[model samples]
Target: MSGHSKWKNIMHKKEKSDAQRAKIFTKIGREIAVAVKEGGPDPASNSKLADLIAKAKSNNVPNENIERVIKKAAGGQEKSDYEGIIYEGYGPSGVAVIVETLTDNRNRTAGDLRHYFDKFGGNLGQNGCVSWMFQEKGVIVIEKAADVDEDKLMEDALEAGAVDVNSDDEVFEIFTEPNDLHNVRVALEAKKYNIISAEDERIPSNYVHLDNEDDIKHMNLLLEALEDDDDVQHVWHNWENEGEEN
Candidate 1:
């Protein structure tokens, strides 16, 4: 199971600032609260909550903070009016973009996204406009350490029912069917693999490359603006931006 590695691109684009980390925590906290409200606090019985806990840990969230959020949510102390919404659009040079958000105000989120797209030389489109270019899959990333054996890890991942394994210098990326994510992750954990992150992601089938410097700048600005929004949860796109020095 071999394919192009997207983890490198993801790692390069993620900002490591404290504010960015806090924003990540806030976003994950909202997701956890919603999961707890819908499926209960116990991750043992709540697979969604369990998955989210894994995600939070991978993001370096403190255990105490995760526990506090769960407890608050389970006790009904966390009241959120957030609703999940997806916005599809294009970045400069027709790069397909999809944004997932949890917002209390749809109008505000939509207007903000539209303005960002317009300002960055793109346009927000209707639902499904760019979604068709992507496929949903379970993506699990394991940090590559000195002790990690690439061949062994690949074998184990395949045995765990992963569909593909992609590797770079820093990490191993395992792809699995969406429904099998938790099971595959548990299997890997049982084998003593140190997971970096495990989550469902929309992967683009094809990538768009921009040769124009203006288009590249606009694309980067659009992505940054969307990611900075408090309401935005995840942003998926098909820009082949590896080695661009973000």
Candidate 2:
């Protein structure tokens, strides 16, 4: 089973619930603000900002909201200086978990994250604890449009520096080296492909399957709590999907 994609599906299902859209907006807005602060408000001059803009649009973030965040960051309205922090931990059934956060106050965010881990069936760990189990990779998602030729698309991606490509019912997942993401994405765009999402992500080396009901419940809670935090940007984990078979 593909753990990351299955978990993404679960997250998408939950996004249908009330208030989830607001949460998504907030998360994407924070990303946009950070990108602008790091580079600039102009996507043309800032590759990172451009990628974030594409991501926000793929997630259905309103154009006005993205513009507002970029303008605010550029105008110094976002006064709080945030730093990126990664927290490693183990969820139920010893599933490796990594939480990425952008925080202005490290102490508070750490404390809250520790509390969530403790409240669930997990314990926070030191840096590099479980990160070794994952490798950084670029993931590009393209929707499976009508009349699209899968083999031809795969050939194009490979020729454009993509390392791997996988297709399912809904989308084609392309993998590339972290540094080659933008280049490969631009190449695909030149071919007039509809890019659904493109970003750097951690790919787990292995997955731990949770069959026990209690473990599944606790793991779900742990994921939910971590994702709910305002400082938390991304949560990577190695849990085998329940419905998807290897």
Candidate 3:
């Protein structure tokens, strides 16, 4: 119910809508910049940067842009290198929310996020707000590995401490609790499985389905604004797309 799956599900639909497409690239790029600056610009040596790069590639961001960002960080020209922050809150219907942001100015980022939540039928909470309702995890999505055997992949993932696995039409997704992500990723790599993207995400323990269509329309407005922020990298909520069987 939480973590990567929820985000992925939303993004999958949004990608085709052309909504937030530009903002998506901006946020992902900022993530790439921060990861490189903090970890020394060597993806091989910096797992964080490597993961961000993988995500950028999936979204079709140009390699030149990524390379330029890495070089800028390496050269120290960028001011106030960004860092990721998790803001906990709640949405309508008591739905838990977690917003992950990468910002160069914590004060500005905090204020922007808080203002949005307050304006959109939700209120930002203290640090522990709603976070207790989630579990941190790593989600890996492999696009259409048709030749690969599911059981074998699951077995390898389990040996690496993977918690669960699921597949839909053209994607194979693997989940590993936060602590096991690195180990599980390494295991998968050793097997030469093609991985499309991987990242740290929050997953909710329970979901609050908006029974009213109007609630979804409004909830989406809030989610959209949160995502449009340049500093916001990911938004997780206990929302189920109507009629989506999870």
Candidate 4:
């Protein structure tokens, strides 16, 4: 919910950079396959499948491709034995970091993740080493307009059971507990409001502010290295931006 604009801005910048859209598609396809295998392909009866479909569409995944994936899952042609793993650690500048990954090869993924952390001046740690610094939350994004009534939006979201809300210059963001995400989203949809994006995220409880240029470079390298991992779905960290909400 906090710094909603910053989060949306970061995502917009990311979605436009498609050096390997295939990788993104593969990731989404994998998730879709997993969801279908676990709960069946009927989105109406499977909330996870429905969410994956929406995400795939937002990412411009083709309808034919989505259908093929659904068929593959329905026919049991795809293997989705992957397990979700979360690795926590501390990055440069004592920044708390959490990485969420889905992998079929746990050994390979774990080894690679540990190696990257060690090489990047970041150390992988025990379960609660850094996880205590983050809280899992549901985030819903809405694109901003030049003129919008913030109070009205806040009132609506609060009534819909959003736990907290934040607004940046270009977006209104709503946060909810993980279990409440779907309900709030359903409430919003009933009102004819379309969310630009919605996802489960780990927001850091606090932040570590960088001081020197060298520190910035070091941290960026660590983040980039972690992001390059194929198994990685999302990376969360506790780095502060002094620039504040825009």
Top TM-score prediction, candidate number: 1
* Candidate 3: stretches off by over 4 Å: 1-10, 13-22, 186-192, 242-246
Better of 1 and 3 by TM-score: 1
User: All candidates' lDDT scores?
Assistant: 0.87, 0.84, 0.75, 0.78
Q: Report the C-alpha displacement of residue 20, candidate 1, in angstroms.
A: 2.0
lDDT of 1: 0.87
Cα lDDT for residue 184, model 2?
Answer: 93
Task: Give the alpha carbon lDDT tens digit for every residue of 196-245 in model 1.
Answer: 78989999989887888888878878887888899999998888873363
Candidate 4 similarity to native, TM-score: 0.89
> Roughly what TM-score does model 1 have, to 2 decimal places?
0.93
Candidate 2 overall Cα lDDT vs. reference? 0.84
What is the per-residue lDDT of model 2 for residues 105-150, given as tens digits with 9 covering 90 to 100? 9999999999998888899999999999999988888878996799
* Prediction-by-prediction clash tally: 0, 1, 4, 0
The TM-scores of all predictions, comma-separated, are 0.93, 0.92, 0.85, 0.89
Q: List the residue pairs that clash in candidate 4.
A: none
Q: What lDDT does model 4 reach?
A: 0.78
Q: Candidate 4's residue-wise lDDT over 1-246, tens digit each?
A: 347534843664365446668877888888888889889999889887877787788777899989899999889888658788999988766888898988999999889988887887778888889988888888877767544567877888889889888887667788988877777777876766657777777887777877767667766777777767789887888777522222
- What stretches of model 2 exceed 4 Å from their correct place? 1-19, 242-246
